[model samples]
Structure formats: C-alpha cells, structure tokens
Target chain A: MKCNRTDIDTETRLELEGALDALTAPEIRPIFDKVVTDGRKRVTVDIHKVTMIDSSGIGAIVSLFKRIKAEGGQVLVIGARDQPLAVFKLLKLDRVFGL
Target chain B: MNAETKPSDAGEPTVTHVTFRLRASLAHRSLAIGLVSTLVEHVKSADRDFRNAITTAFGEAFNNVVIHGYRNRTDGMLDVEAELGSDHMTLRLIDDGVQADLSSVTPPDLSTLPEGGLGIFMIHALVDEVVYDSGTRNVLSLTKRT
Candidate 1:
C-alpha cells in the first residue's frame, strides 16, 4: 500500500493504493500507528483505489481507529468499493465508521 | 489442468474443477486468489454478487490454511480444488499442517469491533457453508451459492 499524507488544519488524509492483505498489512501497520501517535487530529483514509483487502488489512484499520478515537480524534474512511466495501459491510464496520 | 469439464449431450449442467497445490506461505496467497478467480470467471452467467462472494470467501479460506493451519511454514502442504457448478461453487482445501483448534475458533463479538478474531467469522458469513474435518489430514470444504 502507498500512503500519501495531506496535512490540513483539521485532518491528515492518507491516500492508500494497492491491495491490503497479509503481505502488505505489516508495512502499513507501523505507519498508521505513528500517524495516530503523532497526534493527527482527524484521519481520513481514502481506500478508493484499494483493490483487495483481507482481515489483516481490516485489523490495521481497526487498530488505527481505536487509537485515534481513544485520543479524542475521529477516523473517516472514504471511497471504499468492490471487495473492500463488501468486507466493510459484512463486518459492519460501515456502520461503525458511519459510511 | 485439473479443471476438467464433463459436457453432457442431454442438457445437463457441466461440472468442471481445477486443482493446485500451494506452499503454505503468504506469498502464494495471491496465486490462490488468481486460480479461484479464473474458475469463477469461467461461470459467465453467475451474477456479480456471487462471483464476489466466492472470490472473497476463497481468499479467506486459503489464508486460514497458510496462516493458521500452516503457521507460515513454507514446507506445509495445501491442496486447493475449485469446482464451478451451474448455480454455486465448491472449494475443497486439503492441508498437511497443524490442525486448527476448532473449539477456540468461534465468531467474534461484532459489538466490540475486534480485529484478530474476525477472519473465521467473516469466512463463515461470506460462504453458504463451511465444513471442517481434522484427522490424518485437515480438510476444509467451503461452498458458496451463486
């Protein structure tokens, strides 16, 4: 996954591309964690270009959500489609994220 | 190609299957998906939802074999056979690896938004049925209705 950071006054948006699975999940886990730890006020994750996502990818996002929410910030997941969207809907993360 | 199709002259639905053995490694996960995708694609009449389910569920099942059953061991054996039926798909997965302790593998509580324990849960939810047998060899039979 490729993460492009956009820092704004209210949020930090990471435009991620490629497949998020067991192979790529590890590479992004630390980066996501650091983004939260660095006090990113609001997180917007764009998964529009993500082709496939497995449990590992979902785990990284959930972990990121937990940390950011605990730190009094919110996470906004945008533009999820296809397999990734189905996964989010099945797991009911869509409701959690209010997507 | 193990995906031999039996065509019937009497208007019977043709049954076809393709089999491949995979090294139980994460590196082979994409190959597993690609193999199943080809099989799913062969069924041209199936709708988008059905194809998507088979693709996602098969990926989850293959991941379990490699990550949970084999525990990332490259030497572990996982044999995947996928069949394209007229209205559904069947995947027979045989793995020579450590047996999964099924008793502990239960559905995750969705209220908690747990991450790690959701793989098996998602697999069960996405597929029509999941049958697991453990003995001399571990077998996971997954069926998804198209």
Candidate 2:
C-alpha cells in the first residue's frame, strides 16, 4: 500500500492506494504515529484507491482512531467502497466512523 | 492448471476444483486472494456481496497461516485448493507450519473497538463453516454458501 499525507491547517489527510493487508499495513504505522505525535486534531483517511483490505489494515486504522480519540481528536474515514466497505460494515466500524 | 470439472446429473450444479501452491508470506497474499476472487467471480458472476465475502474470508485465512502458522517465515509453502459449485464455494489452505490453537480464539467485543482479534472473528462471520485440522501439515477449510 502507498500512503501519502497532506496537511492543511490542523487537519491531516492520508491517501492510501493499493491493497492494505498484513504486509502493507505496517508501512503506514510510521505515518499514523506522526499524525499522533504531531498532535493533529483532525485526520482524514482516504481509501478510494485501495482495492482490498484485511483485518490488519482495519487494525491500523482502529489503532489510529483510538489514539486520536483518546486525545480529543477526530479521525474521518472516507471513500470506503466494495470489499473494504463490506469489511467496515461487518466490523460495525462504519457506524463508529460514520463512513 | 490443476483444474477439474465433474459432470453433473440433471438439476444438479457442476463442481469445479482447482489447486495451486504459493509461497507462505505476506507478499504472496494478494496472489492467493486473487485466485479465489477470480474463481468466485466466475462461479457467482453477478453477486458482488458473495464475491466480497469469499475474497475477504480467504484473505484472512491466508494471513493467519502466514503470520501465525508460518511465523512470518518465507521458507514455508502453502497449498490452496478451491472448490466451486452452484450454491457454495470451499477453499482449503494447507501449510507446513506450526498448528494454530483454534480453541484460544475468541471474538472481540465490537463495542470496545478492539483492533487485533477481528481477523478470526470476521472469517467466522463471513463464511458458513470453518474447519482446521493439524498433523503433519495444517489445513484450514473455509466454506461459504450462497
């Protein structure tokens, strides 16, 4: 998976592409940590280009959400469709993230 | 191209079987999933939900073998066999790695927003049956019925 980060004001947007599974989820951990360490209050994850996602991918997003929520920040997940959308719905994260 | 098609009787669906081997690693996960996804698409054709469920479940099962069973060792090899029918699809993943303690797995509390325990839970939720057996090699069978 490829992750690109863009910052505008206090919000950080992360754009992910390709398949986000066990192998590729770890590649984005550093970026997730940076968002937390930098103390960004608003974060957006765009998965429009992600063709597939597994539990590990979900875990990474959940981890980021938890960390951000703990600090009174918000994480917005956008562009979840197809297989990734089904997974989010199955895990009930669509309700939590308002996807 | 280890694919076989069996003749079906009247009013019965033909069964097609395909088997292949893959390197047990995270890098090779997409290939395994793609094969299953293609087979599901071929069999189910227009059912998007069915395709998603099988693809997701198979991906998780493959991840488990590579991450837990193989312990992230690339030296391990996996044999995957898929059976497709009119109303159901089955995938068998065989690996020569440490057997997973299936009894130890429990569903994560979704209310708590847990992260790590969702893989196994999702597999069970998406498929009709999941069976694992271990001896000389471990085999995880996932079947989903339409």
Candidate 3:
C-alpha cells in the first residue's frame, strides 16, 4: 500500500492506494500516528485508489477517526468504491464516515 | 490448483470444484483472495456485486484464519476448496491452527463505530450461509446464492 500525506492550512489529506489489508496496514501506522499526534483539525482520507480493504484496513481508519474525533477534530473519507465501499456499507460505516 | 467438473442430470447445473493450498500468513492473503476472485469471474463474470461480495467475504475469512486462528503465526498452511455452480458458490477453508469459537462471534454495533470485530460480521452478512466445524482440522464453509 502507498500512503501520501499533504497539509493544506489545517486540513490533512491522506491519499491511499493499493490493497489496504493486514499486510499493508502496519506499513502505514506511522501516518496514522502522526495524524493523531499532530491533532489536525480536518483530515480527509482518499481511498479511491485502494483496490481492496479488509477489517484490518478499516480498523486503521476507524482508530484514526476515533482519536481525531476524541480531540474535537473532524475527518472526512472520500473516494471509496468497489470492495472497499461494500465493506464500508456492510459495517454501516458509510454513514458514520460520511462516505 | 486442481479443478474438476461434475456431470449433472438433464436439467441440473454442472458444478466445478477447485482446491488449492497456501501458507497461512498475511503475505499470501491477497494471492488466496485473488484466486477466488478469478473463480468468481469465471462463474459470474458480469456481476460486479457478486464478485465483490465473494472476494470480500473470502478475504475476511482468510484474514480470520491467519490472525485469530493462527495467532499471527506464519508456519501453518490453509487449504481452500471452492464449489462453483450456475447460480451459487461455496468456499470451504480448512486449517489446523487454533479453532475459532464460532458461537462467541456477534455483529458489532455500528452505532459504536467499532472496528476490530467487523471481520466475522462481514463474512456472515455478505454470504447466504456460514457453517463452521472444528475437528481434526477447522473447516469454514461460506455459501452464496443468487
């Protein structure tokens, strides 16, 4: 998986590509940690390039969302399609994450 | 991959059975999922939703075996058998790792926005039936019908 981070004003945009499964989730842990520690006010996660996603991939995003929200920050997840979108809808996270 | 086609009656749909084995680890998870996805494409090539459901459920099941059953250990192996027919598909995953307590798994409350527990839930929701048995080896069967 490839994770790229960009900061614009107070928002942090994360562009994720490739399969975001168990094997790749750990590789992006540092990005998740930085987003939380930095306490960005707005974070946008783009998963359009993510071909597949499992529970572990979802966990990474949910963990980041929870921590950011706990600190009064906002997170927006955009560009979810195919298998990843199906999973998000199945877990009812589409509405929660405003996908 | 070993595949065979079963002869059927005049009106019965022919069933194609395929089986393969892989190392039970995250590294091989995508390979396993991709094999199943290809099988699904061969059977129901045009239905994107069907392909997505099968692949997603199969991926989660594989993840469960590697993460929960093997406890992240990579020395084990996973055997997968897929039965594909005209209107349905069934995937059986066999493993000798730690047996999962199927009774203890429950759907996570989406209101809580929990993350870790959705694996089993996704496997159950995306398929028509899920059957799990633990004996000399653990077998998990997931079936989906159109």
Candidate 4:
C-alpha cells in the first residue's frame, strides 16, 4: 500500500491506495507519526483509493486515532467502502468517529 | 466414484476436482442482495435464518476481503473456498496481493470516531470465528452454523 499526503488548510489529508492489509500497514505508520508530530489537531484520512483492508490495517488506524486524541486532537475518516464501513458500524465506531 | 484414479498414462487424463471461483465488484448499496444471493446459491438452501446468518457473517468478511484484503484492488480476485456442510459452512479466503500482519492488526478504540481499523472488529463481531494466517500465502478462514 502507498500513502500520499496533502495539506488542505487546517486538515492534513492522507490518501491511501492499494491494499492496507497487515503487511502494508507499517508502511503508513511513519506518515501518521509525522502528521502527529507536526502538531496538527485535526486529521482526515481519505480512503477513496484504498481497496482492501484487514484486521492489521484497522489496528494501525486505531493506533493513529488514539495517539492523536491523546493530545486533545480530533480525527475524521472519509470515503470508506463496503467492508470497512460495515466494520466501523458494527463496532459502534460510526457513532464514536462520526464517519 | 472411483477412490483411486491414479492410472498414470498420457491419455488416461488426470482429473482435478473443480473448485468454483466467482469474482465481482459489489457496491455498498447492494450489500444485502449480493451477499444473500451469492451465499445462498453457493450453499444451496433457502433457510431464512441460515441465509440471514451467512449473509451477516460473510457480508462482513467479504467486505474486509475486498476493501482491506485486496485493498479494493478494482482488479483483484476474491478467492473463496466454500465447503458446504450439513451443520456448518466453512469459507477460506486466499488473496495473493494483500498480506495481513495478523499480530499487529487490532480493533479500533470503541470510544472514539476512529478514522480507521474496524474491519477485523466487525468480522470478529458478526462471525462465529475468524482466523488469519499469513506467510507466502495470506489466508482468512471464517465459519458459521446453519
């Protein structure tokens, strides 16, 4: 999986493309860390390009959310497809994350 | 059915059991229709509850396979193994493109609006059991009762 970044006003947007499965998640972690270190309070992850997701990919995303929230920041997710959206809703994360 | 057909001859023809593999890109709007129709026909039964359960469980699993496993690889194949049984159904998913790190993938925090990481959580929540084995091959096994 490849993650590209763009700065749009106050939101730091992440564009994830390809498989975000277990093996590829680590490739995106550094970007998440850099975003947090930049002191960005509001983050938006755009997954319109992201195709597949697995448990590990989900875990990495959760870790990013927690790490960001610990600093009193907010996280937003955009454009989740079939399986990932169902996962978020089933875990009651739709309400938690307001996706 | 002949138990042993290993007559190793050039024209004897070795028969390998044919396994059906279906591939499609299903939109979110057709989630219920796609899942129910596909799974029921594959399993060859019309039990409402069984269909419901299979649809519910496999729906989440397939979603993950497509969206997460193959990363919605518009060109990816959702390799499925559907072993029909009298009491239960077993599905094994194999995808060469998506390699999941079974150890590190965890459920997102339930208390927050997670920007990500809920696929596995839902798969675990809806199915009787979900297992992931990763290596040269990435495999996901899901089971549901009739």
Candidate 5:
C-alpha cells in the first residue's frame, strides 16, 4: 500500500492506494499513527484508490480511530470505493467513522 | 497453479479443481487471493458485487488456514481447490495443519468496533453456505449462489 500525505491547514489528509488487507494493513498502521499523533488534531483518510480490504484492514483503521480519539483528535475517512467500501459498510464502520 | 474447465450435464461451464498452495506468509496469502480473484473474475466478471464477496470470503478462509491452521509453518503443504458452476461457486480448502474447532465461530459484536475476530464473521455473512470438516483433514467448503 502507498499513502500520499498532505497537510491541508489543520487536517492531515492521507490518500491511500492499493489493498488494505492483513498484508498491507501492518505497513500502514505506523504511518497512520504518526499522522495522527504528530500534533495533528484533525485527520482525513481518503481511500478512493484502495482496491481491496478485509477484517485486518478494518482493525488497523479502528485502532487509528481509537488512538486519535483518545488524544482528543478528530478523524474523518472519505472516498472509499469498490471492495473496500463494501467491507466498511458490512461492518458498519462507515457509519461509525461517518465516512 | 493447476485448473480445469469443463461443461457439466447442465451445460454450464464448470471450472473444476483449481488448486493452489497456501504458504505461511502474508505475501503468499496475497498471491493466493490474487489467483482466486482472477479465477472468480473469469466466471463472474460482469457482476462486481458477487466477485468481491467471493474474493473476500475466500481470502479470509485462506488466511485462517495459514495463521490458525498451520501456525505460520512454511514447511507444510496446504492446498485449496475451487469449482465454479453456473449458478453457484464452491471452494474446497484442504490443509494438513491442526484441525479447527468452529463451533464457537460467530461474528463479533460490531458495535464494539473490534480490531480482530471479524474474519470468520465476514465469511459467514458473504457466503451462502459454509461447512468446515475437522475429520482427518481440515476442509473448508464454501458456496455462494447467485
């Protein structure tokens, strides 16, 4: 997986590409944690280009959300499509994340 | 990578006994998923929704064989087979790893926003029928009817 990080004002936008399964989720967790913990209060994860995702991927995203919320930071996920989007909806993470 | 395609008595194209190895790593899991997705695409390319369900469920099941079944042992041989019929798809996954106790397998509470334990849940939700055989060999039979 690849992430293009950009700072838009106060929010850190992470545009994610590729699969978000067990294999790729581990690679992105640290990057996501850094983006949220590095003095960034507002964050947006754009998964428009993500082709696939599974339970492990959802776990990584949930972990990121919990960490950000614990630190009093707000996180938003957007632009999810295809198989990854179906997974989010099936698990109702889309509603929880307000994506 | 071994596969065979034939027409059954019903005249529907049946992709039979498409078998592949299940290695003990994430990269191999990804490779297996890619192979399964390609085969599924050949049978259900026009329907993206069904294609996604098959791929996701099969991926989870295959992952279980590596992680829970074999305990990440790379030396063992594990094979998964698939048969694509016109109305449905069936996957027969066989592994020589430890047999799984699936009586307690269920979807975790989604309200809690769990990190793990969602793989089995997703499999049951996506597939039409799933049966696990723990006798002798650990065989996972999954079918999705469209």
Candidate 6:
C-alpha cells in the first residue's frame, strides 16, 4: 500500500492507496501515532484508493482511532470501499468513526 | 499441432487451476480476495462444500500470512495457488519471511478471549484440515473435502 501525508493548518490528512493488510499496516502506524502526539484535534484519513482491508489493517485503524479519540480528537475515514468497507460495517466501526 | 490429442485422456475431467503472485503486503489482500472469490464462484456448483469451507479458510490463512508473516516488510511476494477437483479443493500459500517455529508456536488458548490469537483457531475451525510448515519459507496448506 502507498500512503501520502498532507498537512493543512489544523487538520492532518493521510491519503492511502492499495491494500491495507498485514504487510502495510506498520508503514502507516507511525504517522498516525505522530499525528496524535502532535496534538492534532482533527485527523482525516483518505482511503479513496484503498481496495481491501483485513483484521490487521482494521487493528491499525482501530489503534489510531483510539489514540486520537483519547486525546479528544476526531478521526474520519473517507472513501473506504469493497471488503474494507464491509469489515468496518461488520465490526460496527462505521458508527464509531461516523464515516 | 492444435488438432493433435490423446483420445483416451479426453474422457478425464478437467481440473481448474488458479494462481496469483502478489507482493506480501496489506494492500494486496483485496486482490487475493478477488482472485479467491473468482475461483470459489467457478467451482461452487461442482464442489459447494469444498468451496464454502476453503473460501473461509483462505481468507484466514492469507490474512495471517499477509499480516503476521510479512509483518512490517512490504517487499517480498506472496505466491498463492489453488486447485479445484471433483471432491475437494486445496490451497497453498508460499511466502518468504521470518518463519516462526511451528513446533515452538503453541496454539493460543481460546478460553481466555485473546484478541489476536484467534486467527489460527478460526482457520482450523473453518477448514477440514490445516497445516503449517515453517522452514526457509513459510508455507500454509489448507484442504477441504466436498
């Protein structure tokens, strides 16, 4: 998977493409962690190009959501599709993320 | 050359072969699913039982390899192969990664509600048989009988 970082003022947007699975979760984790540490109040993760997600990928997203939410920040996932979207729906994370 | 054929072998049933070579990374999981689903759909009528069980098992096994075996490495390729027969289907996944000692790796105790440890258990539960061979490479083989 490929990830691009875009920061504009207070919102940090992480745009992701390709498959978010076990192999690529680590590459994106540190960025989310840093955003949380930087005290960003609103983070937008763009998954427009993402085509699939598995448990590990879901775990990574969940970890980021938890961390950012703990700091009273909001995390929004945009443009999730196919299996990744099914997973979020299955786990009821859609309600949690308000996506 | 196109017309040359063995008449005796013509009566034998044809077996479907499917293969995919994808870089062992999280982003390829969707590709794997798409490929596997196509195979399942192709053989569903002939081998519904095997198709159902194997489709679930493949999801779990492929997910495990893509997630745990590759872990942080996104450079290696994962080779996936599946064969459909009259009575059964078999899936073989090959990956180059740090092979965990299958002997040393104990099955996670499922009674405790461990979060990440349920993958293997779920794989075992979904398929008729599951095998893991750890050596220079990690190869997972799963089979189901229809």
Q: Score the docking of each candidate (DockQ).
A: 0.83, 0.93, 0.88, 0.13, 0.79, 0.13
By summed lDDT, which 10 consecutive residues of candidate 2 chain A come out lowest?
A20-29
Give the RMSD in angstroms, all C-alphas superposed, for model 4: 11.0
Superposition-based RMSD of candidate 6 using all C-alpha atoms, in angstroms: 6.8
Q: Return the interface RMSD of model 3.
A: 0.8
True contacts kept of 1: 0.79
The CAPRI class of candidate 5 is medium
Every candidate's TM-score, chain A alone: 0.96, 0.98, 0.98, 0.89, 0.92, 0.93
What DockQ number belongs to candidate 1?
Answer: 0.83
- Candidate order by decreasing TM-score: 3, 2, 1, 5, 6, 4
The CAPRI-style docking tier of model 6 reads incorrect
What are the iRMS values of all candidates? 0.9, 0.5, 0.8, 7.7, 0.9, 5.0
Question: Per-residue lDDT for B10-129 in model 4, tens only?
Answer: 855332211334453444314332534454544444365455445555554666655666664777665666555445556666666677654334665667545555545555665576
True contacts kept of 3: 0.90
Sort the candidates on DockQ, descending order: 2, 3, 1, 5, 4, 6
lDDT of 3 at A19: 98
Please list the residue runs of candidate 1 whose C-alpha ends up more than 4 Å from where it truly belongs after superposition.
B9-11, B101-105
**lDDT, residue B36, candidate 6:** 72
Model 5, range A58-95, lDDT digits (tens) per residue? 88889888888888987788998789888999899888
Which residue ranges in model 2 land beyond 4 Å of their true spot?
B103-105
List of clashing residue pairs for candidate 5: none
RMSD of each: 1.8, 1.5, 1.4, 11.0, 2.2, 6.8
Error of 5 at A54 (Å): 1.2
Candidate 2: give the clashing pairs: none
Tell me the spans in candidate 6 whose CA falls farther than 4 Å from its real position: B1-41, B44-59, B63-81, B85-146
Q: Give the TM-score of candidate 5 (chain A).
A: 0.92
Q: On residues A22-70, what C-alpha lDDT tens digit does candidate 2 reach at each position? A: 9899998899999999999899999999999999999999999999999
